[model samples]
Target: MARDTGPGLARGSTARGRGATRSPGWALAVILTLICVVAGLVPGRPGTVALAVPFALLALSGRDHRTGARSGTEPLVLISTDRHLTRSTSTLRLLLTPRPKEEPTKTLAAPSLVAITLAAPGCPADGLVLQADEECPLVADIPVSGEIAVLSYGSAGVSADVVRPTDFVQAPPVRVSVLPQVGPTLARPVSRRLSGLSGSHTSRRPGEGGELRSIAPMQPGDQQRRIDWRATARRSTDQDMLMVRRTFADAEASVVLVVDRANDLPASTEDWFAAGTSTLGQGSLHVARTAAATVAASYLAAGDRVGLDDLSGTRRPLRSAAGSRQLEQIRTRLAGMSVVPRRRHRRDPVPPQGAVVIIFSAFLDEEPARLLRLWHAQGHPVIGVDCVPVLQRTESSRAQDQTVRLTLLRRRLLLEDLQTEGITVLSGSVQDEPGRQSEREHGAPLPDAAGTDLDTGLRLLARQSRRGAGLSAAPGTARGIR
Candidate 1:
């Protein structure tokens, strides 16, 4: 069965066929020259004709040169379509000039050759394949149809199409499997972890020990028992954590997602960001979605109620909480997010006080670093995920000498700058494989920590989430940028 390999994704031949026909001036100049010679040979007016003969020959010669310059000896392509079968077949053969009054014979085969076979279900029982020798010359017995499929040989990247038969219908759809990653864990503290906290302490009545006095916003390392459940429940969703001292009821933590859209970053970096925003998986939107997903997933998994504030691409922030419906809502929002240029002079709206803030971004510029400092000053435990672009240079010829050197230098400088701050930067290139070896080889350095695979980070995060440690910080702030 012949299939229509969609445009840009075809799997077969890659060369193009030759163009048809040559310039007409070559033949015309030859005929004109002959006429001038014959006129000079005539007896009547021979002297006058002789003088004109040189000029005519000169003009004819110039015309011949012009014609020859424009003429090309490329092959002619013949594409035949079987209307009944809706199949298309193309043939390529060269046309070389022959002796006078003799027919032009097909010589060389077309250079670019491609053949596609499309077969519909329950259609024809037979097919024909064409065979060619070392030199693909035109043969009188070329097979046009039969049971075997004939494919022309040529370069790896050739362009060719197979004509389908009229009786053929569209091909059937094939099933493809999408592998899943290891399931969620408790070791990683994502924004979603805050939600589960609410359910875990739901049985305890409020106002048993602490009064609802308004104090300063809560920071990391604060006691979880002091969390203002009523205020936290009202302000944020399952994706944001709420920390409070026993002294305050309305205290909340403000979380911000700072995505960097700088010129120095790699192209399609936004795509990765978008992917993370869409899901909790480790890819693009990880900055926006990962911490949020982790927090929400962890909180819900641990019975803590939490809330989420989406600052990506919105005039007004999207706010939701930790519930079955809320989780679905967060997923839907992340999935639909598109990368947008940040507006100048506008700050991301901050969540209420005591809200656990998870900042996600590539950290390509000083803006994210500055923002992290600001959030830290305000007493929020800011977890930064640095989405680093992977550099690839397979062919030395494709890159300039200076460009490659500059890239390596830039990465080093950026890593140093990120570490200077207290941010836990995870630098991973998309080009790196998902396995442990690839992660160990290309993984970014963690602050004060040894290098580890990407799976290690993810597994740790997942385990943390499953254990209700969503808000717990790693022993010391470890930063890595690969």
Candidate 2:
């Protein structure tokens, strides 16, 4: 398999082999030849022999043999996308370029046209119609977007002209991460104890900044820039003593978003206890990704360092950074995260020292709650984001209903206990609406309600941050469903 990753483009290709059945045209020719032979057996049909000869020739014309591919090289089918990262939609193109042997022999020829069927979670089932053109590579535009799109080759059309040594070499799945559409710019939860020299948030200490901290008599080492001439004149009649303006210094905060990818429960309550057959975009993992992206973007926009961490321990944690590129990296990483069941315990993530930690999870397990207490103990302003979507009750078995009720009760108690420990709880639940089905099917942006709830939760957290009490400021803070 061949893979290419260029700027803004993702490409993967399949290697060719030999072992294909006769093509439809060959089957038709063979049937015709057999019919002609049978008809020629009739004493009255003398012209059938002539017809049988032509049909037999046609049937043998496209006989399969050693593939036309060179001994060392195989014909390739490549799939490319205009962009690997898309918020809504992108165009994917497939190209089939056949490499024939240099020395021609009695071997089979390369396929003139290659038909391919692609399968994805939310894509068409029918095989794509490809127009064969020897001069140009086959082109078929595939529209891919929404939540996450993983494309893989399904089946290829069989032809007698081409033979393979083995099955087609399957190319790796091409993953396109569609970053979530966020709502209005959110009020990022700033750390109470900020760091770094320069940022958007105002620090408690006085230095060079826009927001005035206090005004007092000019002291030694106070530059002329810090001196308030107006205040000096008003306070000192003869201008003997000068008054200087002191402003709070600007500092940046480090925020690490821990995303749990263990379970992805859907919003429909009835589907909670069922197998993992929930719709692709309508699950806890989607909500978690969306919330993490939204929060990371907001904080990054505020000149804060934001990082990403997966709780399932499937990948390394991204270091905190403040930039547009960092934001892109975080979103891409979030979009690529999938449910990875943890069979054994893994080491907890170690974020930057004194960094604020925000976790996005369904809170169905004790891991998130334990982490919340651990971060709080470490003096990091911790916020727990419940990514479980709004549940809608439906008719179900009594046992399943009891199980759901018991699970919810346990989750609620866990959250309440965390809140008692001064951990601010936030909701990132995606609401299940009537119009969401169309949006999911059509690759539209996610509902803004989820972002709105997150925004509100962070706003309250921000308010708490300003009051010198970050997580402890909001005890028992719960929003969304139960």
Candidate 3:
């Protein structure tokens, strides 16, 4: 299959094979001839013999168009996707140019129309017979798989040649982003876990013009208007000690989504075709992407800087940014990952200091455990989003079932441990129901982790993480984050 880069255009030849393209005119002639023959067999129908001769002659007239194409050289096909804003579904037009007509051996040839149907690797659209000048609209379900749409074609129509040969055409695969099932807008803005220079997250830093942090003794640089006269006078005695007001600095945080694609996508029951069924099965890639996109959009909407890191190599590494374009880029990149990546574990990147990283994975492997643990040890708040399979399923025997049970037990324990370390872990299934975290999972209580609706709690956690009791900070010290 060939790949074309720009959005919505796929051009390529079919999978290699020599097949016949036959004209329908001969089939019509055969039917007429059979009718004539039947009439002649009946009593007092001698004129039917004359009619049968003409019908037989007509059957042998049209030349099939199958002469030019040879083995491994299927006909060229053009597939273009068009979006109609008013219509909910998009349309894909397949423009087929049949092999040019050869020397006409038979007179009164069939129409130049060629019938095309999907052959190996079934297509999203039903079969269509189209003229060289005309394009047919496919009954395609758009965005069938991530960004790449898979389709194959074969000749059902006869070429304008003697013997009326046929050719099966497997068109090239294309990348397309049509309708995506983006989840509902978050009920609340995502909460960030770190104190940073600037963002929508209210910071732990003490500064001017924000929610009151506390009141303290008036210092030399303290503004005169900041004096809390009521508190100062109440605390005042024979001595002249003064009091002033303090407030927190409004700041923002950075969020990075680490999407894990390094595993065999569990076979999707939905996209996977079964015996006598056409509904396609979708898999873990869809699940992972849905969770990742949702996480990115939520955090970006909360005014936190968001970046993407994919283990699957389907996307380039994106720097953290809070912009509409960033969201679009992320979505587009995610939608285009049509192929499921092979499982390959590698070293995880060390997240930048104070960045809250969300790891989206199935959590079936131990690599995520090690990676998340490393992030935690570095003091970066890590949230684990377990991307449970949506369309993909793995076959299992009794031993596999026991193994799965053991793995789940281990997974639950690992997540519980992560929570104990202050890393937030959530299930992809319950993503929309944020309240599920409040409940115990396999007897583990979540730390009210990041992205919780409780911003104040996260703010307090950020303050704790940044306050006087950290690795770089001394027992008593004053510092400012730029």
Candidate that would win on TM-score: 2
The CA lDDT of each predicted structure is 0.37, 0.64, 0.56
**All candidates' TM-scores?**
0.38, 0.69, 0.61
Q: Compared with the true structure, what per-residue lDDT tens digits does model 3 show for residues 175-258?
A: 456433556443222233445565554555777535577888999988898999888888876449888889766565677878
lDDT of 2 by residue, 1-482 (tens): 76556643431111123433445566777888888878887766868867878667767775542232224323235455533244323344444333333565454444445555556645554454343333223233332213344566632323434322222444455555566545456776665667788887665667766667789998899898888999998989998999999887767778899988888877676877666342454577877887888888788887789988878887778989999999888877876776788545556667677688889988888998888888788778788888877655542898876777677777877877877776777778644465557545654333222233677777776665555532222222211110
Q: Candidate 3, after superposition: displacement of residue 136 in Å?
A: 3.7
lDDT (10s digit) by residue, model 1, range 272-360: 22222211123334333434454455445543334544333343444634456655554444444434556564654565454445555
From the highest TM-score down, the ranking of the candidates is 2, 3, 1
Give lDDT for model 1. 0.37
Output the better candidate (1/2) by lDDT: 2
TM-score of 2: 0.69
- Candidate 2: stretches off by over 4 Å: 1-77, 82-106, 112-115, 122-125, 128-149, 154-172, 268-279, 343-347, 391-406, 430-452, 467-482
Off by over 4 Å in 3: 1-66, 69-78, 82-111, 119-126, 130-135, 143-145, 154-157, 160-169, 178-196, 215-244, 264-282, 313-315, 338-347, 390-423, 430-482
- How accurate locally is residue 340 in candidate 1, as Cα lDDT from 0 to 100? 54
Candidate no. 3 TM-score: 0.61
Backbone clashes, each candidate:
106, 7, 37
